[model samples]
Target: MLAVIRYTVPESQSQDFAKQGQTILDTFAGQPGFLRGRLARSVDEPNLWALVTEWEGAGFYRRALSAARLVMYPLMILMVNEPSAYEDVHAQDGT
Candidate 1:
């Protein structure tokens, strides 16, 4: 199944969060079951953003979320692990 994880951070830690998030995405982009990240634009300010990251499958999504919780967002997250699930198939491969 396809998965989407969303979250928000407090306004104050936006910069730090964004920087670390970019690093994490870079680090995990090519991992098995990792798909791609869809970054959201801040509706209010530069500091605010909505992230909609889609993974290749839900198992990968769960494992990644667990690690991200432990390794990332030790302080800045206002919410976490907000994931939605559905059937997903790669467009190019139709698999």
Candidate 2:
């Protein structure tokens, strides 16, 4: 499963955004079933950013969220309001 949380941040806040994202990623690393995560900026839209993470399953993602709620709240509160969970249907084999 994938969880993608997007944010609209001004260029001035880019550094802060990345810093906070790294902290959140570190917190997630301690949770069970966390595969990998990335903090990326959009090439087309400089101010757009995404916190993308792969999980073993939706359940794992949910559990991670519940477990890290306090540590994640600051950054999570900045996320765009929308559905963020997805099931992979066509990922490359062995990836």
Candidate 3:
């Protein structure tokens, strides 16, 4: 499962936002089912940032989030929209 959170940061806050994003990613990296995660900035929209993470499954992702609520709740306030979770429906080889 993939979890994605997007944020619209002001130029003045971009550095601070990136640092916060790195903390979130690092926290997730230490969890049981975290597969991979990244922080990205949109080329055309510099203030647009995203946190993308892959988990073993949706259940693991949900559980991890619940367990980390104390740390995540504050971070959630920075998001421009609700975070989303996606299930992969197909693969490059058509699996």
Candidate 4:
């Protein structure tokens, strides 16, 4: 299994941004390579969140995310909290 961890502080108008961001994330469920996902947000920071994602084997997260980021950056620049990223890793399969 592979995990992708992305964290970021969204801009001031986080509502709309987070909505679309969730749409983008939800799209992964329809993706042929997608496995599962875990979405989390900071209790102290409303705009801060970490999307822990799982994939089947390997994938091209960068390129795919680059496209999503393009849409996300412009509308939600003010909420920039932390770093947004995807990480590669090994995990034990529960199923």
Candidate with the greatest TM-score versus the true structure: 2
Candidate 4, residue 74: Cα displacement in angstroms equals 4.0
Maximum-lDDT candidate? 2
Residue 10, candidate 2: Cα error in Å is 1.4
Query: How well is each residue in 1-95 modelled by candidate 4, as lDDT tens digits?
Result: 44444446545655665676577677666556676776667788766665666665445454455546654465454444545444555546496
- Model 4, poorest ten-residue lDDT window? 77-86
lDDT: which is higher, 1 or 3? 3
Which regions of candidate 2 are displaced past 4 Å? 93-95
Please list the residue runs of candidate 3 whose C-alpha ends up more than 4 Å from where it truly belongs after superposition. 93-95
Question: Taking the tens digit of each residue's C-alpha lDDT, what string does model 1 give over 1-95?
Answer: 55544456667777777776676676456457777775564676654455556677778877876666644555335544554666654545555
Higher-TM-score candidate of 2 and 4: 2
TM, every model: 0.60, 0.89, 0.85, 0.55
Per-residue error for 47 in candidate 1, Å, reads: 5.9
2 or 3: which has the higher lDDT?
2
> Which should have the higher TM-score, number 1 or number 3?
3
TM match of model 3 to true structure: 0.85
* Residue 94, candidate 3: alpha-carbon lDDT: 50
What is the Cα root-mean-square deviation between model 1 and the actual structure? 4.4
Total colliding residue pairs, candidate 3? 0
Worst lDDT run of 10 residues, candidate 3, spans 68-77
Using lDDT as the yardstick, the better of models 2 and 4 is: 2
Cα distance off (Å), candidate 3, residue 6: 0.6
Q: Which sequence of candidate numbers ranks them by TM-score, best first?
A: 2, 3, 1, 4
